[model samples]
Target: MASMFRAASVAFFCILSIAVADAQPIKPSASTQGFHSRARLIGGGQQGEHWLAGIEITLDQGFKTYWRTPGDSGLPPRFDWSGSENVASTEIRWPAPKRHEDAAGVAYVYGKQAVIPVLVKPKDPTKPIRLVLALEYGVCKDICIPANADLTLDLSGADSERKAIEAALAKVPLLQKLGAQADLSILSIAPVAGDKPAFTVTIQAPPGTKPALFPEGPENWFFSASHPAEGDRFTVTIEEKPKDVSGPVPLHLTLVAGDKAVETEVSLDENGKPR
Candidate 1:
């Protein structure tokens, strides 16, 4: 009886230790090339209000990452946090990306490192928040190499984490200003007769500025075969399908003024109507 009691005590203690270790939060590891990825929660998690979060990627020397729309080739990084508790919703707020063209193809990417801001809302602040980011991005040199990571972050009463997130969020506005701030006025959107329906987007930009417009949505709905006619006014021919006609589509316009770049989002009217 004495031996059995001792054995039971030992077993219980071992189980308790394992449980404690399992409950401890896990920190994400940076890439071997010194590419670190992290996420943190900022302010405003009270009651019904949403909080701000940041997902940051710090790249090493000679490494590059893709943008939301990676142009002809290259896959954009993806995030998956379906099992998070106390996280009502999460969204990625991307800065304007630059255009890159090489022998491989045309692509959009963020050189060096980038901090992607996100909005997070919690249904109940009392519960602990666990966010998992499963990211897959392509890094290019002469050829493209695919990289993936499963990054996990804790977002419950972490003041230090909040501060770091806020710092990252602070940079977003400045980055936007540096990238694309071209004020584009949509003059018209008209339909054309073809095997696939099409629409022409006529825009007016600031004098001495050449802006490139990229559709933010899926490629099947919005094709990029159109050419840009330069003048005081610029025109881009876009394919208009049933999928593209559901609602307004936002275009990320990047204007290059000398060596500087500015990005702006313009919404198009439905049914190819002038806006």
Candidate 2:
């Protein structure tokens, strides 16, 4: 009986070691001559309702990553979280993007190392959460490289790493403010020609202010190359819907003046125009 008990203890120890090793944090890696990416869970215990996760992308010395709008030359980042359990929803808050122009054209994006913050809410407060993200993005140098990565993060309610997560969450407020203070009165949206359903938006930026407009919803309804025209006013052609699209479509705009950012929401008019 004594020998049997000792053997059982040894086996348990080995299993515990394997489990701990499997839970180690993931490191960034590169597949091609492009960008390297890493993801990790940050805060878990401070707030019982939500946790923070950070995804960082380090572009190779000369390569660049695409923005939410990848312009005409790159592919936008794609994320999938079908395997996540105990997660109510994941919210990705992006930092303000900059405008980059080369021989191809002017593109808006974040270069170098960009830290994207994600908020994860768990359905059960007592259970541990597993988040699996399948991400695909394009990195451009002289040529563009399409890359994919699988990122996993285990969230524990009692983890000590929560402190770092909370710090990252602090930077998100600036981005949130950028999405909340756009000057909507400068934009005039109206139905356009063609029966296929479309609209034209003329944006008037304040003198010396170059603003870019980003639509918050109905992702399929707008054109991909809606660049904000510079000068006293700008105009962008957007594809409208035959009728109001299902669900709620909140027209959130992001206005950037140099390094300053502001956001505003535009409500739909009675005629389906962006008011």
Candidate 3:
């Protein structure tokens, strides 16, 4: 009877050991070297029903990278995950970006380091996932250099990089409805009549905070950064309006102030009124 009890105890200990091993943090994949930069894939364990991951780019001092909407004269990062397995869908989240004005033009960029958070939904959550990413982006100092990287990782356990991923996630702008009433929100949008059609935006922000606006419109449409016209009022002019496209234009606007940020979408007609 004592021998039987010992055998059962040993079996229970083995199962516990396996569970602990599975929960251990996974190491980041090998980095792909680039000019004054390096890129790699990092697992961030699981968050609720979906798995979290990050594409970490470490840049040398004085080097920077572009955001999803590279304001004026930069290349945005492009990601391809056709080589991945067990991924049903993947969503890349962009953190609030900073505005930089140089000879090239006003651009939105990240300096020093950038970690882009990715939320991946697995086709089968019970099975292990193999994440493979093909990334193409640009790093700029004085001149811009295009870079590419191929990174892969088998994600079945937690990762030590989870904390870093969460930090990036915190910077991602929260989604809010257009004209939402909040301490930091877009109060109103109106049409500005000029040589070129423009929109005037009024935002509500905390006192002593300087706010900036980033606007994204339909394909082939480019807009200038919101220029402050007066107190709490800014104007965004249409730079390049797509040819042969008429009717209402949809705008995705991101507003950032100090440590608060939010994103909202609205559509306007030729008259600049909400459509």
Candidate 4:
């Protein structure tokens, strides 16, 4: 009996060691130590000026993180590069996020790991970019805690890591072209005129399959979560629009229908035709 008990204890130690190795923290300036994350510089375009980048995050077992729009709950990951030099603009291109559920509600998150593709535009293309990033994101299982990282990657030597960036870039979602007829394409986004002014987005998807629609926009506007109507169309009711708005409103939509998904950012004229 004593020998059997010792065997079990050894097995437990081995399992714990494996989990710890898998969830090792990323080497960074400051972090909560729950997960590991860092910024990576991909190579420049082939004979072009633009460069690619990514944020690689690895979470421990049973832990999760949020997307830009964490439906109903959770804090979205935030990145700030104001301290960096020779950088004019930076855009984060998110891959399709996974949906997670808890007692509080649903959350769109990255389970276990995620790589967020980034587009970096520099003030001078000829010179190297000294990119710096300060990232803050939530890590949750039952209780959520904030995790922070300070990462710096010199772009001069990014050529060595070309393949890694290429792999992540492949996951970035491409924009849906106008007048696409494929079943995965979002056919139309029309205004629903009634008691509550809403935008009815119709996706050309499979019948009876409920599609998941995620809306991305400024912080002030609220685009209520949508559901699949009868047939191939889905309706996204606009709960609120910006007040005293004058410029054109561009709505970005990501539609997930089964294994197939697509995204588009387009502006609609008052008449609802694609603009």
Candidate 5:
């Protein structure tokens, strides 16, 4: 009877130790320095089948980094996870970007500090995940400079940074259907005859909301940065396009009003009528 009790006590203590180890916070990797910028990896332990992670970037004052789709000028960030172990796939969730204009052109970017959340899926849920990242990105002030970073982390369990990662995730634009009746919505898009293709986009937003629009299209398609017009209207002009292009153009429009943003897709013909 005494032997049985001792065995049970040992098993309980081992299980408790494992639990505590899993709950301990995972430390972030050291920062990889770049020109006027630095980058590193921070993570929130496993949520379910995937781990919540973030790429934290700090930029020098007056410097900025480009979004996944950099407007007319800078290059978008490229993340390579091929060196990772026990990883199945990873998705980088981008928060809505602010539009910046300069003598070069209009560009969408993140200023000062940016935390980009990533969802990492592992091949084996029960085992630890070794995350390796080779990040290639660009930063700009008066001129643009290419930057690179190599970072790695071992995610054995949960980390204290989960809440911060969640906060960044919240800033990612909620995908919405075009013309949805929401607090901030795209009401209409009409074609404007111009030297090049152009459209007048009208949005319905609250009185206190200061709205901005960013349009994205396929390769070889470029649009003039949108600016506020009379009332809730904004005009988007086509700056460049393929010579063989014809018919309706499919565009992904990101509407940002204050701290909230929504992305929607619309197909517009030469008449600006939605098809």
Candidate 6:
């Protein structure tokens, strides 16, 4: 799971693109080749059973970086931690990304500075762990510039990164159980009634929800432009059916509404309604 998380790209972007406990200021080394980036370990993360950590990317004024799924163009970030000690696995996660539209297309990105959170597990619960990270990412403006960062940290004592780490972690979208509801809800899904087997999802949200959604689907398939159809109603188009698949094609969505975000997964039948 950690390996996959480290490799998984979304825009919470380890492809998309910090913290401590009560907090000693653990300033990690900067990557000489890329944007200013370092590793951080949060003390007693969330439930207190595992350590929370991530990579921090600091972009200068007017510069931007891509998300895990960089909408149209841009490179995703990657993490390699084989140099660390006392490590078991790591789950790299992303905070919701802002939508950036350019002549290149629509790409998800972080404006100014970005702090990406990672969930870390140790090989020994009783011993300390040193996390070494080799990260690669891209920053853009008129043209895209590729960057790399190598950072390391030993988490044993001192926990001063809590505030920053928690702040970043809090931005991550909360995952709801299957078929559960939250501040957001999916109102409808239906087939496009064409040979493409495409579908449309209608979302019902509060007034001025300004919801921005991210799609998780199968390969060779993607989501089209999402726009407001009517008041508080928006539609997202899925391009095609799941290829080489069976039972049901499950689609996942992450909706970001200002400070609130929720993630949900649904399996739809041929008609596009959640089954």
State each model's CA lDDT, in order. 0.57, 0.59, 0.87, 0.68, 0.85, 0.68
Candidate 1 segments exceeding 4 Å error: 1-48, 156-182, 191-199, 216-219, 225-228, 231-275
Residues 1-275, candidate 4: write the lDDT tens digits.
99999999999999999999989965543222434433233443422455676676778788888888876678788999886678888888777776566697667788776777667788988787766787888888887778877776666644654566666556555689645888777777676665655666777776655577787655566655545665555565555656655445677888776655678887744333335
Q: Which candidate leads in lDDT?
A: 3
Q: Which stretches of candidate 2 lie over 4 Å from their true place?
A: 1-48, 157-211, 214-232, 238-252, 265-275
TM-score of each: 0.61, 0.61, 0.86, 0.69, 0.84, 0.76
Ranking by TM-score: 3, 5, 6, 4, 1, 2
Candidate 5, 1-275: lDDT as tens digits? 99999999999999999999999865435468889999988889878778999998999999999998899899899999998999999999999999898999889999999999999999988777888898898899988899988889887676878988998888898888867898888887887787877888888777787787888887778887567887689998888777776668788888888888888888866443346
On residues 211-263, what C-alpha lDDT tens digit does candidate 3 reach at each position? Answer: 88999988788888655667588888888876576667789889989888999
Q: Which structure is stronger by TM-score: 2 or 4? A: 4
Tens-place lDDT digits, model 2, residues 27-136: 53321133453333343453546776656666756667876766546777887878778888888877656667688765656676666667788888678887777778
Clashes of each: 7, 7, 0, 1, 1, 18
lDDT-better candidate, 3 vs 4: 3
Off by over 4 Å in 4: 1-47, 122-127, 158-161, 177-179, 191-195, 206-210, 240-248, 258-260, 266-275
Poorly placed runs, candidate 5 (over 4 Å): 1-30, 246-249, 269-274
Report residue 184 deviation for candidate 2 (angstroms).
Answer: 9.8
Better of 1 and 6 by lDDT: 6
In model 1, state the lDDT of residue 243.
42
**Clashing pairs in model 1, backbone N/Cα/C closer than 3 A:** 179-261, 179-262, 179-263, 180-262, 180-263, 181-262, 181-263
Query: Least accurate stretch of 10 residues (summed lDDT) in model 5?
Result: 266-275
Q: With candidate 1 superimposed using the best TM-score fit, by how many Å does residue 113's alpha carbon deviate from the native?
A: 0.9
Clashing pairs in 3: none
